[model samples]
Target: MISQNTINTVFETARVEEVIGDFVNLKRAGSNFKGLSPFSDERSPSFMVSPAKGIWKDFSTGKGGNSVKFLMEHSQFTYPEAIRYLARKYNIEIEETEQTDAEKAITDVRESMYLVSEFAKDYFHRTLINSEEGKAIGLSYFKERGFTNETIKKFDLGYSPETWDALTKEALGKGYKLEFLESTGLTIPREDRPFDRFKGRVMFPIQSMSGRVLGFGGRILTNDKKAAKYLNSPESDIYHKSKVLYGIYQAKQSIAKQNNCYLVEGYTDVIQFNQAGIENVVASSGTALTPDQIRLINRLTRNITVLFDGDAAGLRASIRGIDLILEEGMNVRVCGFPDGEDPDSFARKNSHDELVAYLEENSKDFIQFKASLLMKDAKNDPIKKADLIRDMVTSISKIPDRIQREVYTQECARIMDISEQVLVSTLAQLIQKDLTEANKKQKQEQKPFEVLRNQNPKNTGYSGGDPDDPRTGPPDGYMEEPGYPQQQQAEKVDILYRLERKVIEILLLYGDKTEEFEDVFLKSNDEGEVVMVSEKKQYKVHQRIYLSLQEDEVELSNNLFRDIFTDIIGFYHQNEKFSLEQYLMRLEPDFAQEVTDILMEDERLALHDWEGQNIFTKGKHETIAQYVSETVMSMRWFLVGKIIEELKSSIQPENSDNTELLSMVMDYSKLVNSFSKKLGRVMSRYH
Candidate 1:
């Protein structure tokens, strides 16, 4: 188990903005930073980070939490792994208790798989460099393609031996389980025999963005006519080809730093680009791009440049991915090599500067590239031209940003030699169709129990309350006012709000401030008629408030306030400074959400855009902060007065002529006067 001290250090030292900023580009917005939501496909900035609160909120996804929760959600890291990640980032040493035998047994399965994969990677790389067959075949093939030793190691390029059962036997001899080896797809088993899965093939280790080996891709070396050129591991618990992108682990930092990514089609394509000094590149491993892959890139950057071979099939297949990227709200551009060349072959032929320059000049926006490619096929055929225009409009409609969609529409109109008005009308129709479909779906999927209220209600036919009953009458003594109950509810809400605000302010600002105030004393009721008896105590107002809440039976409607009140009572016992920053930094998402809801509910509209400007000179209501401050002071004074009244009522002079009773009354009066003076000072400051 992780020690409490370790957890405290991790929570206190890790900053939300610092941890998330590694993977996201955050620009300053007010006291917070704003960025596009990484959890969803969003164009506008809806992810906010508050440095003071040490938490983040994605308004788009409605997920908000402290730094640890962010890592756990974003990277799918386990709790322990998330803690270790932060510990590593902050240079903290972890000292954990040893696991028991049962824990060790459970760990064996995953650990065995990881160890075997690492062993196989090492075994393959050794064969490539040391064995004559691997050196003559696999090594020569890679060297001929201009891959240096560093590039080979960077991509974990390796060669598997041709001998069957060589790897399987070695792995089993190392105390590794045969079942785990088979599960990872490193070994194949039949009814009576088993062998290494990648025997006689060059290996490409498919990895997750965190560099964990998920699976492998292997290429056969021999030119046998019946042999398949390449084979990949079947989908397993750790590896899903559709969700994995090659070189993502290596390229993610560069992609985030450069604010652009280069998408390629093969393992060698990624290696070649990285070798050619273009680091922000990843490959699809020859599969169609999936939404999962798009979201992975979306977390890093919104701009993507797809590099394709200049062949006809490549262009045809590449255009299909453009629409998917558009649907994800990503900015996409296309760049192709010279005819008959791919990223691998082109990078080999040109210098880094020349290749980069070529890509820069040839890269075109999706609409322009699509138009240029299709214009040749639709030349002078009216039906084909119309179909092409509609296809382009369909792609444009997928863009979430209206401004970008309109710009693409204008570019398409110019490229196709069509009227701008025609394209605009087509786009408008498409948008309306999309909206109509969305509304239809929403209605069809509406919840069965949702309520709808009427615009107006008729009065009831009878009234039960007496006309002169004070309990039923308005305070002004007129006919009982309509919505009087609602008015009372509003007043109750205001009282709760003011009280909570004062408590939070004290917790945040004056938690360490210690000032002695008189505490009212109570005597036995029998002493009230004859003489007074009193007991005096010295206490802090903050402590008095804490004690009062503990003694009262009032239930707080706001859950967050109730929790904060409970925490305040605990803090009073501890006699420590109430750290609002630390509390907010470590608060759970549900609690943070509740706090935000309470703080923002029914705020003054005049303060919406105050920005520290005092434009309105409404006496003593110059700013929302000041108004709230005054309201809070009033509520505190009222609560103290109520406590004093309760104490006064407890005295009874009839039982005995006790001097203690008299002292108690004087102490109670003193407490009331001191509380009144303090409250007046607080109100005067705001006024």
Candidate 2:
């Protein structure tokens, strides 16, 4: 178990923007930072981070939370995993207590597979550097490729020995479960016996963006005609090849700093480029480009410069993937090497400056590169040239921005010696065709629901027929209660929910602020008649809100909100000072998430520069007293209205003995009027 003291230290030291910025490309927006949401595909940024509050919110997905919660949501880290990651990032030493067996058991299956994968990474790394067979085989191969000792260790390069069961036996001896070993694909299970999966191969660990080992990609040393040159770990819970990029964990910072990423084809391409001082490079691990992979890069930058080998045939095949990048609304640039050279060999042969200069001089916009490269194949043939023009227009049409599409269309016209007007016409036709197809597909998908509605014309979108549908009545096995209009249930719940939520939001934001409040009460006058009286006093915002709610005998209707209110009040009473960071750390992740959402909900308004446009907005602090009083009074008014509603429902029209119900209704109606008048006065003062 991680000690609370260490957790507090980590929370205090780690900055929310700094931690989230590693994965997101955050740009300053007033006091907050805005970036594209990592959880959703968005061209414009909707994710905001507040450094002062130590919280973040994604307006697109509505996932808001503190720094620890962001890691857990984005990276799928457990609470302890997130804490440990922050600790490592901040270089905080963790103090631990002995965990019970139940605590140990709480480590989930995915984490167990992660542990096994990590173990395999360490085991293979040790073997490559320490074992004699690894030194002779894997070490020699990496050295021949011009990899330095420092570079090898930097990437955690390793080798699996020739023996079939070397890793399997070693892992078993360490008390690692065979089930986890098989599940992670470190040990391939068989009826005869389990064996090492990557025996006699140089190992490259594939890692998550957070630097946790997910799987491995290995290369065979010998030139065996019958065997494949490379193999990758099978799909496991911890690793999905399509969703991850090699070297992203190492390249994210550089990618964000440089605002560009060099996409390559293999593991060595990533490593060689890194060793050559080009740090912002990642590989697809030889797989075709996927939307998820492109999105990984999109989180950091909107520019991609694909590094292709000099082979003409390979370039032709891989050039198609650039359309995928364009479809994502990112800029695509292409660079190729000299004939017969790839990224790995070219980097080895050139100095850092030469490689850098070569890229700058050779890199061209993807459209220009594609047209010029294919122009040779279409030489002097009108039909082929026309086909090539259409191909370029098709790729151009994939761009999401209309301005970019037009710009690329003009460039294509220039490169192909065609008229710009003709290319524009073709682009428009293609875009319209795509839209028509999309609309057709949507209508086809909705056809079933449409038919169902037609067959049952009285369907109210409910399994049990709506009570308002007199022909259907309620569905069988259900009864409609008196004075309960089912249709109004949702509206009634929403009104009270909003009121209760407002109370909680005020308590969270202004709980520690001192304010003078006018407390209202009902008291008996000297004439034995009841009268409403107001007493003015100074109290903390939380104290005032709590006492008001208690005096009215009202509680938050939502379970989560009620728990949060209780906890906030308890913290304020128990501690001399309130720290938002400290309070968030004390709550469970779910509670912490709700608290952050309530606290930072208004911060989204800061994204728009209203003040810059000569339109100003008021901060809640300027009217803390009025805001607090209004929120509490609003809750009281809403509760009193609910009481009157129930009392009115209890008055039976058919029964003779309804005198008490009538009296209660009249009394509650007077209370509602009193609350309404007080609420109106507070609002009038604020306005």
Candidate 3:
């Protein structure tokens, strides 16, 4: 395990902006930096990095965190992986606690498995290059397939000996455990004896995106009728076939740099394509296309071109993958090689320049490719053409972008010689059906949460107390108060969100800075008129915000915001000596991002030097109790207004609390009447 002290050193030395900048291009935006969100497709910049807070936030996807969190989210790195990445970037020496034998044996299953896989990879590569039998069979097979000697070692190509126990005995002698060997699927255990799984096969080491050997893909050289041609590593903790793409480790950089990915169908296809000068290519490793695989590529580039042989079988595979790509909002293109040539054979046959030219010239959008592929079968048949149009519309509907759908629909209509209106209407029907089913699925999944909330109404949405929405009441309530819709109940929760969130933001950012504020006291006069009295008070921002929330007995409705506010307040309460950097370092990646977002919101404004404009912007040290009180009162007014709405909708207005709420709403109205919109209560009955 990594020592906590080492983790702390890494955190302290590493600047979040510096670490994230390696992956994203960020420009100065106020006191912080802003960039396009790497996690989503957006035109304007929404990803913010707060150097002061040591965190970042992607407003687009609601993802935020420190350097470690960004690495984990972007690269799918585990916590340890993320920490190690940051440590390496910052040049911090990783100091790990030594593990005892018992400690090591207990749960280092994954680590041990990784080590064994690495050892096996080296063993197979050596056997293929050095062993006489392996040289004659395995090495020759790779050479015959047009792979250079450099390519062989680059991909860690190897051979498992024909002898069943060769790998097993070698691994055992090398101090590797038999359990990990079997779990990695390197060794198959039977009742009689344990033996190597890929015996007599040429090995292809399959790697994770981090370039670690996760498993192997082996191809049998023998022509035994019953034996399978290819054998892949079984599903294990480290190797999930559906989630792993062959050559991704080598191709990810090129894919991101070129802004395009060339997806093929086999290990040889990927390797040959790479050798032929196309570095940004990944193979499906012979598995059927999966969404997880598509998502893996989506992280690197939004454009994908599937290269298939000009054959019916290859065309089918391309069609199957196209829908998935479009569903992810990716720009997908399809290219078919000359007849009787797959990616491997085609690349081997053509020169590098020729191969590149062919791909560029032939690549077409999936819609055009699919239309052509199906049109051959639909020729001269009116019924078949109609089915083809429907089929094309169905594929178009899978696209999430409305504009893309409309363009494709128009294209499909022109190609099929049908009315664009007909295709559009058909698409609408399909989309509606899809949405209905998706809603049903969501409701089914939410059934448990719904049940829990029903039992605990206080914690759930204020469904029973408030109107369906601020502007609209239920039909029963509408009948009772005809003007209710016109009155609009007046809940500007955005104003509340801004005010409440501002209080928390001030508390977190300026917790240590002392500020004086005008405090308001509410009282009734001798004549029964409400009166407001003000006095100046001084306190830290954190203390003031905490006290205000406590006095009001109010909590934020947004779960993430509420959780962060609670944690920040609690931290300040416990650790009187608040260190912003130290506190930020202790926060989890996701929550830390929230704190950063709050602290860094509109930081560009602060960073832009507004003092030069003769309009002073409040700094952390600025004393503005009046400003703080305005924020607190706005939130208080919003809550009071919400309660008044509840009271107006209450069945028993004559009840003391309901009657009391009416009088309180009226009293609050006098204070807000001038600047705010009209506010009133609903009568108990129409009469």
Candidate 4:
């Protein structure tokens, strides 16, 4: 168990901007930072981070929270893991109570899978480095491939022994369940016996972006014609190859820092390029590109350069992935090596500078590269030439942004020696066809409407319970039951938000401000009725504000106002003078999220140029914090007046003069009048 002190230290020491900035590319927008939403496909910046508040809000998805919540949402890390990650990043030593063996045995399935995979990685590495067979076969193969010891260890390269049951027996003997081994595809189970899945093969552990070992890719050294040369772990709860790219964990920082990614085909390609000093490179491990993988890269960089071999198959694969890349609104450049040379061979044969220069000089935009490469083959054949134009148009049409599509179309027309009008017309047709197919698929997959009865009139009409009922509500649809009137609710929310802002502002900006106020005390009348009386005591303005509210029966209308009022009452009862910094620091995460939302949300007023209107914006009253406080007090008094009216309507004439009720009403009325006068004074001062 982690102690409270450790949690506090983690929260205090972990800088939110630094933590979120690792995964998101944030640009300064006013006082805050804005970035494209990592939770959704967005072109414009909608994800906002407030460093002052230590929180972030995704307006598009409505997911807002502190730094810990962001990690949980973005990286899928458990709470403990998130805390540990932050601790590691901040260099905080964790103090945790040791867990018993029995407690550790009851681990979650996903975490258990992770543990098993990690064990396999360690086992494989030991086999490669320490075992004679592994040294002779796997280590030799890696050395021949020009992989340094540091690179091999960094990538966690390993090898499984030649004996079939060596790994299976060892794992089973260690109390690691055979079922998990089979499920992770690390062991092959038969009727009589079980064997190691990647026997006699060198292992390349594949990891997720967060650096958790998800799966493995094994390469065979022997010439076994019956067996495939390379085999990979099957998809499981933790390992989805389509959604993962090898070397992403190592390349994420460089990719973000450089704002570009270099994509290649195999593990060796990634190693060679990184060893050649190109750090922002990842490999697909020879699989067809997937959208999930593209999005993973998209989160880090807006541009990608695909490094392909000069072979025909590599060219075909590159072309297939171009449309996917374009559809994601990413800029793509293609670079093909010399004939019979892959990225692995080319990088090894050339120096770092030579490879860097070659890439810089040879990289071409997708459309230009495709047109130049394919135009020669379709020179004389009219049908083949027409097909080539259509294919290019099809790729252009896949682009989601219209401006980008149009730009690509113009570039293609110029490169193909074709008329711009013809190319534009063809692109239009292709777009229409794509949209038609998309709409058809959407319609086919859409659920049939069964007419569920509308339960919430505030959201939807049909309050009679039948959705098909024509007479359920007005044609314009069910409006919110006018909860306290739209103008009143807006005013109330504005006032409460303003008041809280004022309190926070005063606390933050002028925490030591001292002013004397007449202390109001609650005294009991003869008939057990409460009466308010002002005493000549020089209390601070902040203290007087709370005492006046507590001594009088001011009914709060806004929920937030009522809550804050209750909290202040409790705080005043416990402490002589509340610590504003401690209050903010000790607020629960949920309350903090709320406070941040209220502070950052629109207050529905424009005062940026108000000073030019001959209005002398005075000290305190002119500030946003003072304005908020006045607004909250006004709303609270208004609600108090309404509640008094409701009570009066319910009272009988005989009870009108009752001392208890009359005194209560009188005290409340005084409080309401006091707030009204304060609000008026603040507004008049601002004007």
Q: Which candidate ranks first by TM-score, i.e. highest?
A: 2
Q: Write one digit per residue (lDDT tens) for candidate 2, span 159-233.
A: 999999999999999989999999988899999999998998999999989888999999988888776799999
Off by over 4 Å in 4: 2-5, 100-106, 173-175, 435-450, 453-458, 461-625, 653-674, 681-687
Worst 10 residues of 4 by lDDT: 602-611
Predicted candidate 1 versus true structure: per-residue lDDT over 242-346, tens digit per residue: 888999988988998889999999999999889999999998888898988887888788999998998998897788899889988899999988898999999
- Candidate 4 lDDT by residue in tens digits, 25-72: 777665677777789886666677877667777766767777788888
Q: Each prediction's TM-score against the native? A: 0.72, 0.89, 0.69, 0.80
- Highest lDDT against the true fold, candidate: 2
**RMSD (Å) per prediction:** 9.7, 5.8, 9.0, 7.3
Clashing pairs in 4: 495-631, 495-632, 498-628, 499-628, 499-629, 502-625
| By TM-score: ranked, best first | 2, 4, 1, 3
Error of 1 at 246 (Å): 1.9
All candidates' lDDT scores?
Answer: 0.73, 0.86, 0.78, 0.75
Error of 4 at 384 (Å): 1.5
Task: State model 2's lDDT.
Answer: 0.86
Backbone clash count for every predicted candidate, in the order shown: 18, 0, 3, 6
Q: Can you give the lDDT of residue 632 in candidate 4?
A: 42
Per-residue alpha-carbon lDDT of candidate 3 for residues 1-687, written as tens digits (9 for 90 to 100): 889898888788888887776556567766688776777765456678888787787867868777877877876666677788778867888989987898656656777888899999999999999999999999999999999998988899999999989999999999999999999999998889899999999999999776678899999999987878999999998899998899998897788778899999999999998888898999999888898888777766789999997788898888888888888778999999878999999999999999999999999988788888889998998899888888888899999999999999988888778899988899999999999999999999999998997885444333334342222333221211223332232223334556667777777767777788656666788999867666787888778877876765677766777888888888888986877777877887567766766665555344334566676645534445655656666565566556656656763635355666567667656544421321133322211
Answer with 1 or 2, whichever has the higher TM-score.
2
